[model samples]
Target: MVSEEADSWGLGEGGSRSWPTSKPERVDDQVTVLNEHRRLSLQEIDNARFSWIHAKICFVAGAGFFADAYDIFAISIIVSMLGYVYGNEDGNLSPWQSTGLKVATPIGNLIGQLVFGSLADIFGRKRVYGAELVLMVTATFGQALAGHGRAVNIVDVLVLWRFVMGIGCGGDYPQSAILMSEFAPIRTRGRLMTAVFSCQGWGQLVAGLVGLITVSAYKGAIRDASYPAIYPVDCIWRIIVGFGCIPGLIAFYFRYTIPETPRFTMDIQRNIAQATRDINNILSARRHTVAKGLSSDTLVMAPRASLADFIKHFSEWNNLKVLVGTAYSWFALDIPFYSLTLNSSAILTYSNFGKIDGNSPNDVYESLFRICSGNLVLTVAGFLPGFWVSFCLIDSWGRKTIQFMGFIVLTVLFMIMGFAYVPLNSTGPGQHAFIFLYCLANFFQNFGPNTTTFIVPGEAFPTRYRSTAYGISAACGKIGAVVAQFALGHTLLNSNKDMQIVLEVLSFVMFTGILSTQLIPETNQKALEYLSNESQEAYITGAIERGVPLYA
Candidate 1:
């Protein structure tokens, strides 16, 4: 080897020509080079064979997130339909009740995330993924058909079904993120996970578009009658909420074809040979016709993991460290995220859409404009820039730094909005500017902590407990959502002062979030399967310590 590179190393002519074959250091260096070359060769072979297959898997896995977004937003859009439907005849329900339809799902989501998330942790992603799709599809379609009967009050049924669907939608967050993260190549894990999550923007956009069209469909009825006829309202709502079922159907088909994560099949299942053969088949298929045979069902033989064993490896000190970090970070992150999102409808009502009046010149137009414009702005301006930032700088800027910066900025904006709300009490430029600033704050929130909190749990955990760790962390996030749903949306929106108080509280939450972020280690260069037992224990215990239990 030295002779071949003699010219480059200047080993020819007067230079020493003999390689240090007798030296242990030189022997070690040679072995290192050979091992590196062999590893690279295997990786190259795998890439050559399986790139397209992995891409297909990513696309399929990503669909779950898309559906989750659509389903979640679809429930929100159904609010307008309900307000039009139920408010017409008896006028018994308040505007709050109409909005409650939107609120009910997140309430359900809190339960679903805890329950289904636990199941995913116990059963594995593939089984839960399929089960969630089935449940969501069934419940969603049930919501659609519930109004078909003449005597049935659609409003009650809508709320009932949404809560059930929420459970399924809620389950998707952890399962989809964990599943994609587990299967992704170490080098591309961040991008792959983000890609799956980024479908959320698409889902929100779909919801807004559906809202736009549905609102327009009922505009005449809404304007002509005290409340639109219940029949038209019910029909429009059924169509809108039913949109959620599409992604579930697509996810079901995709999961049937896709194999479970090789890591999960190997590490958790302990089916090393089957895992190896699966990887080989993926690799072999890259270059030639690999047999399409499924491996023996030996992957399922790994004894079901228990909650006791789940926490079995945790040492108290390290466990507490992780528990505090994950739980605080999630809580901090959700305070701003959920607070803003839950109040989005209220924000639009009072924003540039021309004040919160039942009667105004451009009220309908303004409402439509706010929904579409905000969605477009967030989808294009907020989410795209966030994705770009994460893509370009996540490795370089680091997660903790970016997250802290985002929280600080959000806190400042919330403070401004709170002050602005105190004095600028009317519909004017002050309110307008503050709303724009608030929107800008929300945009940044999505770009930063909103995305990072989800990312951290998956990356911070070891393979053995990755699902459990994320499930518990994600359940914390929903607790934040539940708080936001009940507190910010319903409780705070009763008056402008309430909004100010809510924003003030959120400022404190964000500050705490920034502080908690200090505890988490940077995961930029870490491999998914390589987290330490101590770190894993720290993550779980830390989460439990800080997290208010979902059940409690």
Candidate 2:
């Protein structure tokens, strides 16, 4: 190899070589240094013992998801409240307007995923991490403050702000998942990521708790006369929507100051020396500060990311399959997941849960109370437990195993619910059985594909494309949510037999999800590099001195 390189360069006259300027030996030596340092740091990260840093990273990154979920689902009951405030004399929002309000967030999420997902890769995670939370916090507050403009009703204002908040909500999926994946130890990585993603269950539960609390707080006014007292009803929704921002506000500083993953600092920035120093500070001392002798000029130019490089990497079938697997699995899972979550009130009402008979203010109070209480019960009975169960088993049982099993169970549950809808709703006891089945579906979703889809994409791709790929995958899931809200949600609001058909459709989607799960290789207890399916040798090709970029 040396003789061939010498022959190619014609370094033969007296066997003397060009020295100092653009020295070939310098490039080779730098490659060796990059390889050695990168390998050591990655080993340290993957095998490092569990510590407070891991816990801190889990919660800080996860706080965004909690806030996002709270805002997203809180709108379910809030839509009903807005109906009292903004709806016409009929005390109802037009079906189109209601769907639009509910669908806005998923639309925003799709945009945020595509935009911020790539930005984090191009700039840096730390720079992009807290940015979406800003959008969430600001837009959430904006929703709380929305009022009736002469031309635009409060509903229109809410749709606008919720869409913006949705974008921020969407951005959190990739950002949080990528951060946890990059920072966590391999053995405990799945559990840590699960712990982070499980915040959604708690968020949903709290949305209901807050909804129930607010409705009860205004109980007297709601029961006094005709429709729910408009002022208190307005107050209820605002309080719930406004409260969603508190978590984001609290975690904003920590997220902004969060350390960049050593993987990104090494692989994307190409600074292995600095990356090693980062691993030491984070793992050894649990501090986010960088070591001394930091240089602004250092640039390790090894396989820099580009449009062509990204295309080439994922073009391989092995790589492309995983991306497809994660994307479609999420898409399928969310078709049902969001269909149920975003429309839980409608679905529960369809189930005749705590049904009442009159149209008076007392009737409205009883109905809204039932909706809030039922949501809380569903969440407590199903969502929270499913999340913790996944948390406990993710590391041991493996992601694919749990996903496959969950999908299978979910498919069965949906089929039974759809096929037996008439019989299930025929009797009071049967309706109770139907709700039990409903809760079971919720349980399997969190315990199954819902959690794993978020996890696999974050870890499956290479460091350079990790955030971008996860964004794409998560964006696809949001697309499913959008479709469900726009198409199925609109249909289900009819409160008819359509839910039977929706359940059937969900069954089919879950079955397809099962097929997609076949494509996702098990990410259980595996190193991120192993999942990337890329060669590791000679990872450092060269260096760019003094702020010159090797690849734009």
Model 2 Cα lDDT, one tens digit per residue, 256-319: 7789988898899877657767787887444223222224356766777899999999899999
Summarize candidate 1's per-residue lDDT along 108-130 as a digit string, tens digits: 76677677766766566777677
Models 1 onward score TM values of 0.78, 0.91
**Using alpha carbons, what is the TM-score of model 1?**
0.78
Please give the lDDT score for candidate 2: 0.82
Overall lDDT per candidate, in order of appearance: 0.61, 0.82
- In model 1, residue pairs whose N, Cα or C atoms come closer than 3 Å (at least 3 residues apart or on different chains), thus clashing, are 49-286, 318-538, 319-537, 322-538, 322-539, 322-542, 323-541, 323-542, 323-543, 324-542
CA RMSD, predictions in order: 10.1, 7.3
Q: Count the backbone clashes (under 3 Å) in each candidate.
A: 10, 1
Give the range where candidate 1 is weakest over 10 consecutive residues by summed lDDT: 536-545
